[model samples]
Target: MKKMFNYYSDKYLASWIIKFLDLIVVFVGFVLASLLRFNFEVAGMSLSKLLEQSLITCAVYLVIFSLSKTSDLVMRHTSFTDIHGIFKAVVFSLAILIGMDVFLYEGMDYTGVFLIPKSILIIQALLVMLGISGYRLAAKSIYATFLNSSSALKSNVLIVGADVSSLMTKSTLLNSSKHSIRVIGHVDNHPKLQGKKLDGSPVFQLDNVINSSFLKEKGIDEIIISDATLGPAQKRAVIDSALQYNIKVREVPPHEKWVNGELTENQIKPVRIEDLLGRSEIKLDSINIQNELQGKTVLVTGGAGSIGSEIVRQALFFKPKKVIALDQGETPCYELGNTLKKLPEDIAAKCEIVIADITHFRRMQQIFSKYKPDLVFHAAAYKHVPLMENNASEAVETNVFGTKNIADLALRYKVQKFVMVSTDKAINPTNVMGASKRVAEIYVQALNSQQNSTHYIVTRFGNVLGSNGSVIPLFQKQIEKGGPITITHKDITRYFMTISEACNLVLEAGSIGNGGEIFVFDMGESVKILDLAKKMIQLSGLQEGKDIDIEFVGLRPGEKLYEELLAVEENTLSTHHPKIMRAQIQPVVSDEVKVLMDRLHEKVLHGDDEGVVGGLKQLVPEYISKNSVYSRLDKKSSQAYA
Candidate 1:
């Protein structure tokens, strides 16, 4: 019997079986309705006539059910919509029967006889509606019970929101046979919501104090946060308390991300370190961005890169005339092309992917001349500090010369706005990559000062969380390998932002910049790399120093224990946006800087690494190299200047 029940309970088979059962239920409802109307006496009614009427009613109900497609719904996942569909089918079927009875019985009454009474028809409609809806509800309950019986272990989870997202998440978890989670209650921050109930789950107020003991006493195995409005600090506090109580923490994505208007078990994920950054959500002036970008030809250099590609994606949101995604990497550029192709036809039509190196000045100039882009986003550069320390020539070629090439082209082409993507490393540089970028910044800022038509803007921020070659991916790889995660220094720290946040600021800066301005993003607080690694290990459900060891490999060449966002000589002025600030620094003499840049460019073209490094130090007096072979050059430049 159990085996047969299980076989019929399968999702596909259950739907068909329910349809067949519904037909039988309709016939039975008519028979019972007739018996009730006649008080179980058949002396006045013809048995043949009653059976014929019952068969006709069943046929009508079947036709209505088929039209409504109520039987197509998965019986185990029956929802209010399904029940509503059943109700509509029953009501329509009853209405059609009433029409037939009013006409047919009028003619039969002339002969002083009736086939089926109107009272029985009404009673049958009520009974049929109840039977169909009740069967589905029963099926859903049985399926849930069977699943629970099959699983010996189930986690008691508390959801952290009382809103629609939390309800959907709870329903999805409960209905999914794949997950063994029982929602124990909901916790909300609203005091007025205390003692309320959502779908029979009690709502409890979470005071500012997170008592781990109290949560443990409730047998809460996990806490799922489905509220998007919950701030990062509050989320972090909850996670900390849950961890102290040995309860797992998960989060449901915002309602906007729900699939097919319903949440799913697969969508819930473990809380990430990025969620604890506690930075206010960035709000972009999309109208302003759209006004600037709409119907304009925009060129994005290094569009295959993490930050650059994200900028491309966001730019599409503004409905630009064309986006020229230029990159030198053949594979990444091709992959980007494929990704763009997958976008909606309208959006894909606006994207043009090109493969060309920014260092190739002639090729880039040809592109600028062909497209005549109205706005230029220069994101192409060599950014690895240690790698650039060894390959200073490449760094200078890409970071310094590449930027100059794009900037000069933008000016020559009369591009309206030019936004350069820079790094926090460019501030108080200690490495070739940082110093090269600083040189690029100086060149662009100085160039912008000379330009009247082209408005040059520089947006600088720290590390992006999941960019290619970022520390997060490296740690993930190490964790997957079940071994030591390497950190440069025990005290090393850096600011991190998501790729989306960085790109949004880039677009915002592009729109708001009138002229030469180095826009700095508020990267919240710097995070210790050691702590980040440990948190990642714990989030992976591994004990730090036991399951996964963290090894301090000492600082690499040109690496620093901490990163600075602003130089010693620079200060910041507020912008309209809270997260973005403009750096106020001594203005550069464009002509003098141009002469120096010309010299630096010539040396870089000739592969004179020492000359390039020396020229950089001369241009930026604060370019002090640390743990690098170029330290001697810095000492020499300081002595020479002194």
Candidate 2:
């Protein structure tokens, strides 16, 4: 019973108080009008006439206020909305008050020679409206204070880079009663702001804050770098500092979000794993994008996989006529289909899912004929290095033969474009996977050179972080199991990127490629595998050496110590997208190449693993089998062949 009374008293009684303030406004307005008509004198010329005019003004003000519903405007949060409501209130009040004055003077008060003019009524109404609006404005501030105090929430923030966005971030934090965050201080790269004040918080230099022994002693919680203009390298350095300090760091969304006016507190996210890779963001050309994919029927071969699914998401955003997604995996396909179903109705309708293998040439041909797709993204391939070493024939059959089947069908269907997803392993191959990939790259490039239509382009890059069989998720699972995190080798390093970033580069590649061009993404610096494991453990808030033990096993079969983005012979030519480059590679082909490839495919079909390896080595002379028991070509040939 007591709790119910408190609820009613707090809400219902407070509402009545606000309504009384509105009534006081109406009464005060008429009194001020009467005093103004009497030239500021206390005594009025005719008390009865003044009373009658004041009552009529009060009645008019009440009717307008009720119609405008001005008393119910207390629930607005932002000042902009309040200002809008105030404008409406003033306009409605003046309209009704002036209408009442004209009615009384022209229709009923003609006998009086000393009646009030309508112009004085306008001035008095304006004064009373300003007074009431001012009171409501003050009440809004008081209400915000009450709400903030009741919540007892504050976020502990340490801002980096004292830029304009930093100040805005501070203001947003202070204005919110929703989150429990507080700005403890600011950390800037520039030393000039060391002792400066921002929103009543002390500013400290970043070097002093992180390296100083006393900085962390002050209980500085989270750090935010609000400067969007910082270059990739600078941003990387700041993020590294945050990781070192074990404090979460935040960054703004990309320019696309900013230009769309999507600036908000929630849009700001913690610096992700990709930011540490230190790669520059890709810039896409809108005109080329629209010309290539908008409203066009397209097909993605490995559609349920990481890269393929991202392509489907991005393609649907462009409002394609239809997007055909083909994959062999059941679970991933079902998951992707489910996610697509949850998208907006228009986007959901654009996606079509098909479960099929690319190795079956007949099935791929039928799909092409059925959909008549304008473009195709070929991403299905066997990529695990050590696993491929054990099963070399399957790797060769899928990576080499699968690519040939897709290319042939694209030509048969006269598809406008065919993009083959290639890898850095193809460059100066030393493993079975790399050898097969190199062979596939040669086949596509050679096909593009000879073919008149169906422009064939290749996009090649190194490892992505969370792809199938990636080491990151493996390490995370091992850590969660409360034991050792395994690493193949302490010295091994590989170039890494996020799946989203890689797919965007692929899209940009497709937009810029003409024909027979190999597109290479600018992968950032290679990360040491051992260091990556330690950081992951630290991010989990566990001591690396004590709580979680890291085990360094010897290098696996066919694993390279360092992955390269380009072959020793290939050079890069800059394209319109800074992060994408056109590889200056020579396409190797001969008149008898088709017969040789056909014979090789037959060997793969007949389970002749030895013959397939021999033919693959002969086709791509750069293929050097390393750390494997498989047969290598007797003669060492320096010339790179098709």
Candidate 3:
């Protein structure tokens, strides 16, 4: 039954069959009405006369219908064009019939008029319209029934948001039988849309359908969020409601992803943990940006990762002399290299991917000598909080010593401007990663102040969504595995930015830096971790408590409940990028920096964990420990005393 009337099931043949059926309907309707009007009695009328009159009427009707495509089966579907065709066909056919009876066959139709009364003619036309329209509607109904009954095709869904985007979504859903999901209804925050019907599906308000009882009543197995106008907080709230009901959720991507006004079904992707991050939209200051890095040779270390790759992408549009991509990761480098080559051939030739580790001072020195880069963006760092907490010594080597090496090489090689990427964790740091990053900032700021040779600056931002080791990817994987997604804490919050937006600000900051400045890109606000996880689960087409579960793990070592963008003593000055502010505080660098570096180098070389820890604390006095048991020693001679 389902396969018989499918549009693709011998469409040409079906079209012909429908045309014949329509012709039969037209002939049968006219003949039946003629018989009923005359009571099957015609005085002085032979079978030949009746046959001739009926044949002439049928011929006239067919001619008008054929001219107007009213009898065409290919147009069985109800569309504006089809309606127009029906109107034209009916009007022309009726005109011909009335003309023949009144003019050419005046006396002949006097006999035929008795058989075909005006009432009977109207009745025949109505029957004909129903016969044609009924077939298509019946076919659609049958198809829908078959699709709904199939376990593989059935999808239970609840819509989130009652905005224009959601309305557009509902329109697409009810009009198309191809979509597998059965829209259970909407769950919206707006009061006006609460009791309204979106294409016949009820709009369940937030309070009406957030709990277990309402969800059970609605039979909502999934959720869809169609509102892109929602702020990060409201978006998170809607996701939480779905998660509480154990309903799967889906949503449209942000405006950035919707290119050229096309929002295809495929673009409606599942929400990820990154969507839960509460960084406000970045408003780019194009006027100030045009004055910076337009044609400069920009080198981004670790250019293959999320943040670095984004920087490279945004920088290419500026028509820079060259974007030197540096990273040690093979796969990401290759992928980025291939992607660069495929970009408009002119831009492709300017993007260069180099595999290098920032930790190796000699390697960085050689690269600087070779490239003579006008500007350098040093973004390579070991930034995982708990992991860095466990391996504080490694963190120091990479974050602190690696930064020193890069700054020194940039200065030696006469690099005009250098920008160091810093994180929010660097402010009043608790974890080793944050402390090491803070120390690195001090090292660069000190270098910037000490010399006029190289303009060294630091740019600080918070977490980037979809970056490697980011929580977004972790939640997605957990959802795929069909189990509990672990969040550090319910109240744990952190600042976030889209990877591309973060990188754009980084470039803008580098251009604004003269020397000895620490710039902070305004991360809008902090977002809760638990809420993010639940949103991710909902967006992945899984119910939170039913299909998937979220578990709260205790805070890891050296982790803070919330992250800060600036240190307590630091004040900000407006820069070229409106969102980015330059720290006005002077960097205090003791002459003992080089001496401390020498001892720290020895401790790292000999693999003395205690000496390395002690030296780091002595070098960075602001270093603090949290949720870690590695605070047994003090700053004074702890290495030698051990």
Residues 1-642 of candidate 3: C-alpha lDDT, one tens digit per residue: 555545353444355565677677777777666666677666634556555556665677677777776655443233434655676676677666666655644655455422444655666677667676676556645544555554365667777767666765654444344666788787776777767887678887676565447766767676677866667676776666666766666687764676454355666666666655645566766655555666778788878988888888877887778889999899999989877776899878888888988889888888888888877888878889888777767878888888888888888878888888889888887777887787788778778778898998888988888789988888878888897899878899978788877887887787667888888888876778887776666566566788888898888988879888777787888865578887777546646676777787787777676676677677766666667765665434544522
> Candidates 1 and 3: which is better by lDDT?
1
Q: Score each candidate by Cα lDDT.
A: 0.85, 0.75, 0.73
Could you say which candidate leads in TM-score? 1
lDDT of 3: 0.73
Decreasing TM-score order of the candidates: 1, 2, 3
What is the per-residue lDDT of model 2 for residues 1-642, given as tens digits with 9 covering 90 to 100? Answer: 444433532452244465567667766776776677677887645667766766666666667666666666443233444456656766776676666566767777654523456765776677666777777756555554554455544446777767766775665554454564667887776767779887688887766765555335766556777777767777766666656767667776653565333245676676655566646666667567767898799899899998899988988887679999999999999999899988998888889999999899889888988999999998888888889888777998889998889888899889999998899888888788998988888888888888779898999998887888888888878988986998878898988988888888888789788888999988867789888887777656577778989888877777778888888888999988878888898657645567668777877877776667767777776677766665344354422222
lDDT string, candidate 1, 528-554, tens digits: 999898877877778887798999998
Deviation (Å) of 122 in candidate 2: 8.4
* TM-score for each model: 0.90, 0.73, 0.70
Q: Candidate 2 regions off by >4 Å?
A: 1-156, 160-219, 225-234, 251-269, 292-297, 313-323, 329-352, 386-393, 465-485, 511-514, 534-543, 546-549, 553-557, 569-578, 582-621, 624-642
Clashing pairs in 1: none
